[model samples]
Target: MIIVPASADTERGRPGTTQQFADMQAYNDQMLRAGVFVDGQGLHPTSRGARVTWADGEWSVTDGPFAEAKELIAGFTIIEVSSREEAIEWLKKWPASCAPDPGQHLELRQVYAPEDFGEEFTAELREREEQMREEAARAAARG
Candidate 1:
C-alpha cells in the first residue's frame, strides 16, 4: 500500500486539473499492463469526513476539516512486487505522472498477510478471513 499523505490542496478542498488525472491514468495503465497495479483510488477532502476516537476507555467524535494535513491521507495505491526495491522503483515513476510539489511526499507500506502474524493468526482466523473475502467478492459481482 502506498499512502499519499495529505497535501495543501486536499486540506483546502481544491480539485486536481484534468491533465493531472490524464497523466495519472496513463501511469496507472502502464502499471496495470505490467501486472503490478492491483487497486488505487483518490479520496475527497477531509471536510467531508469525521474521526472517531477511543482513549482512556472513552469514546469521542471529531468532525473535519481536520487541522493536521500532514497526518491525513489523500489517496493510496496498492501494488504487488517481489521486493521493497521493486516497490521503490514503481514509486519513482509516480511523481512523473503525479505533478508533485517540492513538499509533497508519499509513504510506502507493506500490507500484512495472515502469515505475517505467525501462529497468533490461527487457522480458524484464516478460514474466516477467506470466507469474508469471498463474500465480499460475491457481493461486488452481484452489484
Candidate 2:
C-alpha cells in the first residue's frame, strides 16, 4: 500500500465556514469508515508560517507571513491505496467542497517504503520488515 498526502491551493479553497466544515466532516467520516484514511489535516493561513534553509554548516531562517497564495499549502491527507489509479480515484473526491474559484489543485505522490529502494538493499530490508510486522502482530494478539 502507498500513502499519499494532498493539499488545496490557498486561493481557491473553501469559502463558507459552516457548510465547508460539515462537508469535510462527512467526507472524512466516509474515508475513515472505508479504512482508506491514514491521517489528514487542514492548515492555518500562510501568514502564520516560516521558511528555513541550511547549507554548508550554516542556517538561514525567513519570516514568512508568505505574500503569495501559491506558496501556501492549505491541507493534506495520507491515504492507503493499491495503485496510482486508486489513489487518483480517492483524490478525485477531495477538497470536500466546491472551490471558490477554478484553479485549485491537489498534489499526489507515493509514499516510499523499503521495497522502493530496489533489489539490492530492499530485498533484505523487506524480509526484515515482514519479520518485524509478524512479531508485532503476535505481540498484539498475546496482549
Candidate maximizing lDDT: 1
Model 2 CA lDDT for position 64: 55
Mind giving the per-residue lDDT tens digits that candidate 2 earns over 57-140? 999888755666553566667888778898888767754563333464667877887767777766677889889989998998
Runs of candidate 2 exceeding 4 Å displacement: 1-16, 95-100, 118-143
Candidate 2, residue 36: lDDT:
85
Report how far residue 50 has shifted in candidate 2, in Å.
1.2
Determine which window of 10 residues in candidate 2 has minimal summed lDDT.
1-10
True-structure RMSD for candidate 1: 1.4
Estimate the TM-score of every prediction. 0.93, 0.67
Error of 2 at 110 (Å): 1.2
- lDDT for model 1, on a 0 to 1 scale? 0.85
| Root-mean-square deviation per candidate | 1.4, 5.9
Error of 1 at 84 (Å): 0.5
Clashes of each: 0, 0
Q: Tell how far residue 89 is off in model 1, in angstroms.
A: 0.3
